[model samples]
Target: EGSEGFSDLPCERYHLPRPMGRLGKFILPNLLLPRALSDRIGAELLHVVTPYGCAFPTLPVPQVVTIHDLSPLTFPQGSSWMQRAHFHRLLPLILRRSRAIVTHTTRVAEALSRRFPGIGGRVHVIPPGIPSLPIPAGAVPAGRPFALHVGTTEPRKGLEILLDAFREFPLDLYLVGEILDRAELEREIERRGLGGRVRLLGFLPDAQLARLYRAATFLVVASRCEGFGFPPLEAMRAGLPVVASPASAALREVLGPAVLWAPGSDAAALQEGMRRMLQSRETREHFIAAGKAWADRYGWERFCDRIERLYHAVVSGPPRGQGSSAPMRLSQRPDAPQKETPRKREIGTA
Candidate 1:
């Protein structure tokens, strides 16, 4: 799923001309001249696992890049000035030079294509598989049922709407992950008088998180947008049901009927979704079965195998300029043998 891979395969190494500065990383095509390096090392291909929004300068070998999300571009205020500048100045150039682009969801693929036309054919959608979670060590349940929320405390994540909807409920609300918008979140909690009910358990280890996932009633993701809905999918993997607030197309297409979908992101709709999960045992059971089965399809073995095939296609397909113009769909599974993967598999990109 990332570029810091192919370590297990045999490879040669070379010394760069100079160490790159922070900004120099995004503009490496100018400073580092990777094309000259690749030529010297006999490299056949180059992969940027997390290029963010930078560097697709003309290169000797075909380049493949991974883009996590476009949240920074979509919500400019949420990101720093440096990020905005990089995306605006470099991303388009990077996209044009690359042989192919890899993304986690079709929603992102659609957004990328819509934002910058003529690149849809080069974008490949692949929902990455999760790594192994920490061993469960019970700490969150504390003898009370709670709704779990993971990731950052950004406004677009729909935390405000989730609190307004669930604050009146009898259960507790535990938010895990970093607190990016603390002032805003604190203000919301104060206004609602949810001092005791809402707990901001910031940055807990995965062991603690795994415990909460297993014991929670259900996972609620009221996000306005997501590249890949990890919490909901992981909750499903834990045999826990999920309720997504108008689950984005990326999630809907991947999750299918495995999650209970709220028609909107309003308090009323999310409240009703929670009500269904708490009151109806059948609803819980249905999503649990469907969710687990859906989650199983994203095992690391499958992701690695599929991505490897994509690499083989790129390496063997055509010259740097001319390759297949057809779009690739991930819904169909390949009948290839599974390879044991750790972190990322080593491939002969060079």
Candidate 2:
């Protein structure tokens, strides 16, 4: 879904091959590829947009990089030490040199601006957009009322907290994502005696997911933090009431008062939030309406428009520093875009 926002945009895409692991992250993109391939295009380029935070090469062209989140810094346990170390060494340089930086949420943009001083002006908060989904022609999943949580079983997602909260709750809990920490999650579920009640659907296609969303009584998002909380927006788009944790600044900012917010990591708060949504028809209807309204505003059109404007601004603006070797004119520059297959891509806009 990260690349879906650009599907409708008026720009060419170049799906380039990348190397594996450390070689791709450190050597190939940053050093080898540019020297070998950049000159293949006949015209000069206005800006090289890196969807990821770090640039692949030390290119002479202007750059616009996107930082999805600071999860490695905030939740260090979720990633490897090597990955964290790589970011620690390279992020500062990337921030300092990039012409423009894009982030999915204003909270992240603010945090990034604060972390890397003097780049506040360059930080752009262009939230991810959700495409309009036509409700599938089928019956909602038949069963007892269930609260759904859709994301990978990562520490940062706060799935453990959700399990704890659901321990005493009567309703079923449905989790829809690949469990990275499968053994750990299963152990926790067994320890809590929630084996029968909690269902792990693993990864589902869009059609199945849409059906699950429609079938759900409500959606519970207990993520501790995020670059942008898409599940809630997706839930909202499906006309589902959301019960979200207050810890997710991105969710609080994006969904606003539309969701039933549960405080901290407390199980009781989650229980209360879920209960309120289930028992109170007024509350459920209100959130459903508000959530759909809020989610509707963040359509693909608006997302593409902001991105296009940013591209134009970067292309048309004056070049940075006398030592920099950015292209002089937009017309003389040729565009080259890249894309990654979305088959199992879970992070970001997805």
Candidate 3:
């Protein structure tokens, strides 16, 4: 069962409880039992997992829950009421019952610890791995420079700020994900008279996305909060520099000093930062080198190895004489605490 589909992995492999219509919700529950039975028969049920925000049937076997982010809790306005309710009511129960808790970054781990002090010791930070894709070999085109922005359009993504910044620059802007507020964003673009320069290439395929990364001058991450910033690492893998807000702890932990930091929801600061990055050759080269080095640390093999070890530790116990893996070094910067603003929207920008 483990090796059944090794040669042909599906493109969009979403887990159940996805955003679908009434029929999907009705049929999904029925499909689970038979699938779970089949998994049990094949002895692969142990690998079946659920996230912390869902309801699970009572079973004798142990379970693990991965908490990707707490955005719904931190920025409730970004989520639907039902989604927020589910996380608030069901997540704590799930956490208490889980044999272990997995998170992507240390920032999230710390947040989880602070929120639910009970699971402080058991929570683990197993960062997400980037799967290597074939990079297209060629010299990137000149006179067509643009900044890449990935992720859904939401108040938390700081898209408004990014758009404002791009308007100030001569270069073009490429938005590469689904827009949740299509009408509002389009209205904003029209209002700002940025129709010609701003392009929305919604949800490109993986191959195309890789090409986009290679083509881009740099990637911009203006998110107000994130459990882990995947696009920055993806940008790094493509040897692209990253310009990001310091609002996300995961970005700070992962990218460190490699990424150019701007204040989230500050249009003036974002505009200044973007202009500075585009103008400075030395700054761009420094970030490119630093980003590539940072991205190299997170390969799928290393991620899988850490996960497998964690599974063994949970099933049996921690390795003999091994202690906790929490980071020993803390940030010495005076501005670190000032950057931890909760949630604020930057208008007229990305």
Candidate 4:
């Protein structure tokens, strides 16, 4: 959900006319388009935000790819067949050809290293910064206080497990995200008899989300796995206390002691954690204070600085077959007095 600190930053975005419709999102970009397009756009370093990109025939320039998770390979239930195949078959080729790889957590990096053993040296762990969402102007959404759950309807998100724990909570459980599987989720909610207690306020605008985040009693993240747990971290940034399942190594490493962790990933453990959070005033206060301090450590400036430096390092390095003494390109130019041509990077998703 975070954009690698690229939003509003001093970089150019190349908008190749994409085909219309939902299927076109992944189709035209990866299939029809060629790596020669990068040469046409004068791309010094091609950075693919996702792993499923063409690195086979080889790009004219060095490529840097960022892989968010290995969920398709490691946890098949969360992904589609297309995703599983792409990651399993093509991802190794992409990693092999990439000059540098970027991932938010060390957990994902280690996973990649294990999958493609000798590729470890190129992996870079760069944690993303939380967005400073606009301060919502209106009062919180009306009704009973909510235990907020913010994320997509992906199966790995553990919404079903959250459902089991939610059945016991006194408060309404508000889920905020784009509904990826409406029928499945609705049926599950109805089956559990949580139709009234649970509400799916699907895809609210950022302002409304901010209001909910600020006003929620507490945040609950019951994920089976997470490459990086954004909702828990985002909740902390929004000044909401969090009770999360320790399902992801990334979450445990990044948010230790800042959030109340469930004893296990099961519904019973989640319920216990929720009960403790809801019933106690001291636990809430402690996490609220600690969360803010931890969340503040991930500011936009530091994130952007690290990313930009990485970009410079990747682009300035010699070509794959060349010696280290090769000259630096214009992308490597230091930001300076008005005389030099300004450096720019064109961004496009594959």
Candidate 5:
């Protein structure tokens, strides 16, 4: 499964010019400008893999990009006007120019195809692999039994609903992520008298997160939408059952039957779901087994194989036509290699 761009060792650093935050990112030393400069220095194909979708560079070389989500457009309330305007100006152009486009989940691929019909055949679903971190012996967060919530305190995360749900139960609510909507969260914390019970442990490293996951009763995701839900999958890898909102198509698709789905992104639904999980040990264990088995199906090795193939195809193929072309749908590689190799197909993207 090895390839030129696929390195298992620690990544070598590239000290590209850092762009200033916000609107300044579109000017000199912009997000893509450093990438263009890097392209000139290196023979690597530009792969805009991050959630920041507007970073596709203007270069002579072949390019591939991963559009994780369209949250800025679909859920505009969570994004700023500058972000909305930036996406509007650059997203379509980036999609059109990219040699291959990847989405984190099939849900995202379908959504993107609908939103940008021109990008139909180019889109491919490539769910991110769960990091296989060794669980080291460490102190779990010393507290009462808590329901863990991981992610930034954004409106889309539905922290309000989570806090509201916490009022119904005695279980402590432990939130670990950057506090973006601090004032809004604090107000609810105060109003609900959850000062001590609700712990906002901001930005824990992976080691610390592992500890927190071990200590938690279950993972709770109240997000209104997601490109690909990582927390539930991560929790499953740790043999932890999940209580998640089903509003996100990506989350629903990724988690499948692994998570104990909350009926909606509301306080009542979340409370009911958590109550069920807390009340029944059998249910939790069943989900835990299912989750672990489900998580095993995805790994970095498989993702790398697919990505490596895409890079090779893009470099070898001619410039794409405007019309739709068949995607390079990769099948699951066998545990052992066969004597006769399968024929590689002509996959084009525009």
Candidate 6:
């Protein structure tokens, strides 16, 4: 049912094959195939779905590639050569034969349309849904305040810029996610004398993360590019306001007018945004309410319904026009001049 690569491979291998097999079916060619060889042999059977926009080897089957963002194409400096090469080689064909191109946000849909004209009608926006977590009334902490950042360690994540801006604020900065660049980040923290104030709490379990979100004041995201930007949405579900970068269109699309946007790479601008977020109670309350409403709009049942419809459309025929029953409930927030959680104090080094 699935092949090995990196991210989705294990999930496919361990879970996918068993159910299909139990239902009196077996994936052809029992041996695991190398990615390259698989691309060649399974070309006819391939239906490539990925965030990166790239063409794969000539395939006979309908390729339903998912474009998360045009980051590699739009911001080449932050991408690896392998990623760049893969996208460059596969994007054209992927776009050409894609039965239904899926994207996480509307901004990406617009970008895809602008960059590769005539395909706007084919693109479908399927925002990621957060698993429902039980919310206890009055679970939110009264006055314990902290700014949260969640993501892997990477330059494009804008962690360095966030640190620079964070120094100006008095609030504690708690980073929750795996640290991919331990030495580099530690060095930066040391250089900036942020040892005590800025804490990097590596990946946390869902329950713990929820508790942290409940306790936190607000969530902060400073990514240069994001396909979906799950953390802010997750934060919003927990009833927290978000302060994020304007560089990520996905963040802007999902958070809408609820977020406080700060310019990427501008420490001064980030500092100003942070100061305003910390000081304005009215702004905080407004965002909290608006964010909750926005978060509720992205129901998983609705998202799945759209996906199922798109799948049927892709298999049976071409997609309907863009304006045809807008798949998502567009945020009603009036577009203002751009841009733009919570959780524990646990640290881990990797």
TM-score of every candidate relative to the true structure: 0.81, 0.84, 0.79, 0.88, 0.85, 0.72
In candidate 1, which residue pairs clash?
A: 3-49, 6-346
Q: Cα miss at 70, model 2 (Å)?
A: 0.7
Root-mean-square deviation of candidate 5: 5.9
Q: Which stretches of candidate 1 lie over 4 Å from their true place?
A: 1-42, 53-58, 135-141, 320-350
Clash number for candidate 4: 0
Q: Tell me the number of clashing residue pairs for each predicted model.
A: 2, 3, 12, 0, 0, 11
Q: For candidate 2, report its TM-score.
A: 0.84
Compared with the true structure, what per-residue lDDT tens digits does model 6 show for residues 1-350?
22112223222111122223331211111122223224433332233356432244333344466787887777777777766765666465557555567888888888887877767666777885666555655565565367888887767788888888877688888899989878888899888878888778899977778877888878988887777777888888788888887877677777788788875547778888777888999988988998888888877667756765565455455433433433322223233654422111111111
lDDT of 4 at 339: 75
Top of the candidates by lDDT: 4
Evaluated with TM-score, which candidate comes out highest?
Answer: 4
Assess each prediction's global lDDT (C-alpha) against the native: 0.74, 0.73, 0.69, 0.78, 0.76, 0.66
Per-model C-alpha RMSD: 5.3, 6.1, 11.5, 4.0, 5.9, 11.8
> How many Å off is the CA of 287 in candidate 6?
1.6
Against the true structure, candidate 4 has what lDDT?
0.78
**Ranking according to TM-score, highest score first:** 4, 5, 2, 1, 3, 6
Q: By the lDDT metric, which is better: model 2 or model 6?
A: 2
Q: Candidate 2 overall Cα lDDT vs. reference?
A: 0.73
Span of ten consecutive residues with least summed lDDT in model 3: 341-350
Minimal lDDT window, size 10, model 6: 341-350
What is the full ranking by lDDT, best candidate first?
4, 5, 1, 2, 3, 6
Q: How far is candidate 3 from the true structure (C-alpha RMSD, Å)?
A: 11.5
Model 1 residue 258 lDDT score: 86
Model 4 root mean square deviation, Cα atoms: 4.0
